[model samples]
Target chain A: MSASPNQATDSDRSEVTAGIAAVLHPAARGAAREVPDAPPRGRTAWSLLGLSGIGFGLLAVSIVVSVRIGTSGVSYGDLGRSLGSRLGVAEPLPRLLDSLIWDLRVPRVLMAAVVGALLAVCGAVLQAVTRNALADPYLLGVSHGASTGAVLVVVLAIGAGSLGVTGGAFVGALVSFGLLMLLLRRSGLDSVRVVLTGVVVGQLFAAVTSLVLMASGDADATRAITYWLLGSMASARWGVVIVCAIVAALGLAVVWWYSAALDAFSFGADTAASLGINVRRTRIMLLVVTALLTSVAVASVGAIGFVGLIVPHGVRFLVGPLHRALLPFAALAGAVFLVWTDALARVSFAPQEVPVGVFTALIGVPLFLFVLRRRGEL
Target chain B: MRITVEDLSWAVSGTGILCDIDANVTSGETVGLIGPNGSGKSSLLRCIAGLRAPTSGAIRYETSDIHGWSARQIAQYVAFVEQALDSDSDLRVADVVALGRTPFRDRWRGLSHTDRAIIDAALAQVGLADLRSRGWKTLSGGERQRAHIARALAQQPWGIVLDEPTNHLDVRHQLELMRLLTDTDQTVLIALHDLSLAARFCDRLLLLHRGTLVATGPPEDVLTPDRLRDVFEVDAEIGQDSLGHLTVAYRGTA
Candidate 1:
């Protein structure tokens, strides 16, 4: 008899493989099962790294191509010159084109990529902690809370500029998250309670937003607030982009560090505890981190939908469920996905730029349905 | 490791689930816990495994009091297999077994070669190495139980605690699992509903009736006809079979 699987011979391996086949497909005796293949040990890591390299390559192409798609007639040549002159390698372009390429287009595209990555990562963390497949960044009501705060600032003329609105939105998000935490203080942060409480909070904030809109009776302010709530990258600037990038990078790193712990949570709280996880503390910490990331994103832009809900599920289908491989791939795929979608939003109507959020849903619904059909859920 | 429970009592709201119970499991002893339904067997096991804090009692694993120890520290000494634990994820058999290495892992490192070796050994012990890549959803009830046992084995703990582990297993699987439990070197405390299986396999038996430890000793002494009638509400005869195995023949309800 073979002692260990590592020491087994070719014949022994075949026998084991045959046994697996028989178990997986009872009706069709020797046929292979169509289940998602678990990446085999040694070379799997290298292959994942290679795939990440390709993803990065695609993201770079997306950024360059998106930067060129506007009514301003700026081409890839103009983009390269602007970037090269900034790095002291090539001659500077005309002043108007330089600012257009260097300041406006660059910041907007980068913001889209960063927000997409951040939302997707937050969604993955929430889904793992709550063990719910439909979880996303907005599941905590942070986006609705942000919308209410922004509306109040816009209609009443609160502090000062866009900075004031951003600040108000961030504060509003934190307050809603604080209420959620207070409600979950005594409970174990179980799946059903977290989800139901989130829905209730979201509804409360949404109602407040509508009430403020109706009371103002000013059509222009209402229109502006509604456009912002639907989500746009037209307001993207260097300061906002830098802040989102810093927060997103840091948040992704933190979530990646807890990848193994997330995998242990598949069986529920008690099983995770028996495997040495501090279930309550881990759940609280992850919820807080995800909420903070989401608050920053919704404050900078509006409540962008679908990136968070769609990307993690799609990536899991390709990489299997271990978060070690899932998180990074989801981040890269999300960055590429948003850059192209934002480009489409800019050119879809030529003179009028649609909200990128609208396009995200316009594209996300069909893609999500495709993923479900592939998984045989439909 | 020896497990000691000193005057353990647990209560929920205002009602008591377990009350002033004391027991000990010496090193390498296989102790069977037997009682009727709702006899506090599951509560007692949870308290011992550090999953629940008792209302009044102290549990000691070896010499250290487990009052302030974190869940990780407790897991390094004792592995617990819960009854009817299932998942709806895409975790494979190997992935499930790798969970047992959670206590020994650092924050930044993947599983080392030593960890993989131990996982392989655990799977081989439970005869599931051939199905390492098989999905959890595709497995039968018996295979799932065996995989969970393999997970406990991969923990390399000094003791293992189980609650109704054989509940949905077929008869052959039940016998195999008992044989494996008896063969292992780790100390075991198991809750059981099958009296004959318990009598034939366990080194000693502990009987609980309505949150009290009514009897504890060798199987024959603790499982007397009068105790069975009173505690379990069953009329039975206790004797040996022709094959020289201790058996319990139940007549009917008392």
Candidate 2:
């Protein structure tokens, strides 16, 4: 029927309304189809879990081994005795070696692991939210912002009375993130725009940092700024380690909670929205969480480059692209990687410790290139 | 489910995209949304699916206004598939289909036995059971489209809304997809560029012309030569095939 103006009247309405009653039921057509003889859980889950277990094992070994291999070179027996005494399971070692392992190396190594885990998780989440493979906290200007805040304190002595480098870095990271959020809110958080904004903001802050250091003309202040800029766990204390550990754990828990939604995002925003995800709210929440994680890591030990950028990609190659597996695996891999890299930095140049960031870039650039080449992902 | 659109209009920055569109898709009816490019067919589908809000109209799913429902609530009844899904993800095909179960799944819970059965059935229905473990990037264009259909099927929704589902499909797959949609008991609202397929498969057609509803009725009523020439700007001869399906023969652009 043509559904002319007259025919669209009340008589046809009754017939159309009659059809509504049977409409809302689920289709019964596919229920009787023979399901293939596949395992319900599949091998992928078990394999990923096994790989994650291996990653954690490597992290533990890295921490224990790296703790012993530092410049002081405590023997394995002394290391065991030192750990045993700390746990109150055995007789204590001599005062010097005990303090060296329990006091210095243990916390430093632990901080490296925490920072690595934080940065890597942050990178993974950011990459998912922005839908950019290359996204990382450092590349997005979050780390540079923390550097600006830390440098502002060290050079200008703005927070000399109360806020130290860590406090300054935290505030700087938030402020920079606040600016990024503002820009995103205004311009609608497109992936390319976010990366472009981060790059521009990072360069602007870097220039200001340079100008301040050049104008101050103070060698000691410049040295301190340079060391912090290149990132180090040299100043790692028990307090910083504890705080970072808490932040990293909390951040990981939150990211894990949204891991399913994050997987939806890999399909793009429109598809994510169709999957009943509140795309805008989820993106904002994940971005803020990532910024907070990046800030905590940077504030505690400056900005360690490439862990965030490279760890997720490396882990993705191992576990595929599911965020549920990628996030945790990346965290474990990052922890193990940074612990060894910090150890190498300590011994690579002997008396003068090279910045861990330098080693990270040196190793990370090559590894990243290799991964890209292997995946054929430009 | 029955979808009743009452004076639905969508505008962007004061520019109209869909203007005063009114239509009714009855229960289990496969309604084709036919329009040329930029004529607002996709926008109307988005609004109906609750992915976009209409500027000043109401879309009722059954007796409830979908505008006031949460995205999850709306998704429980209506599933929308986009024309082309562009993703760089390396997820396996099974994982991609598992995303359809998201609206039913809790944040902490993994797929249950029932969910797995439904997902498997959907994959089988789409002829992708053998390729469930294949990487998403490895699938051909037609396979990708079928995978998306399988995803919608996994949702177990009461109604399925699709935007240009046949855009990338070859002729065989395109016909297969339309056949599948017509065979389903679920109410379907699909936007299509291929008029002959729409004429053959759709029970009813809503013809949109430059952001307005130009015509609405059964295929034979809506696919007339005058209506095709007016809305699609094409001269077409229409006839009934041996199976009583309406066939359109396009001569040239008007």
The local distance difference test score of each candidate is 0.85, 0.83
Per-model TM-score on C-alpha atoms: 0.90, 0.93
Predicted model with the maximum lDDT? 1
The value of fnat for model 1 is 0.33
Off by over 4 Å in 1: A1-40, B237-239
Q: Write the per-residue lDDT of candidate 2 for residues B1-254, one digit (tens) a residue.
A: 68899999999989999999989998889999999999999889999988899999899887667766667666666788999786887888888888888877767767766667767777877789889999988898888888888888877776899999999788998999988788777789999999889988888999998899999998888888998888888899998789987889989999
Q: By DockQ, who's the top model here? A: 2
> Which ten-residue region of model 1 chain A has the weakest summed lDDT?
A24-33
| DockQ for all models | 0.20, 0.33
Local error of candidate 1 at residue A339 (angstroms)? 1.7
Q: What does chain B score (TM) in every candidate?
A: 0.98, 0.97
Among all windows of 10 consecutive residues in model 2 chain B, the one with the lowest summed lDDT is: B68-77
Query: For residues A1-378, what per-residue lDDT tens digits would candidate 1 score against the true structure?
Result: 111223233355345434533342121122122322333577877888888889899999899888998877788788989999989999999999899988899999999899889988898888888898899999999999898888889888998988888888998899888988898888779988999898899899999989999999889888888888878888899999999999999999888888888988888887788887888888888899999999999999888899999999899888878888888888888888888888888899978989888999999999999998987667
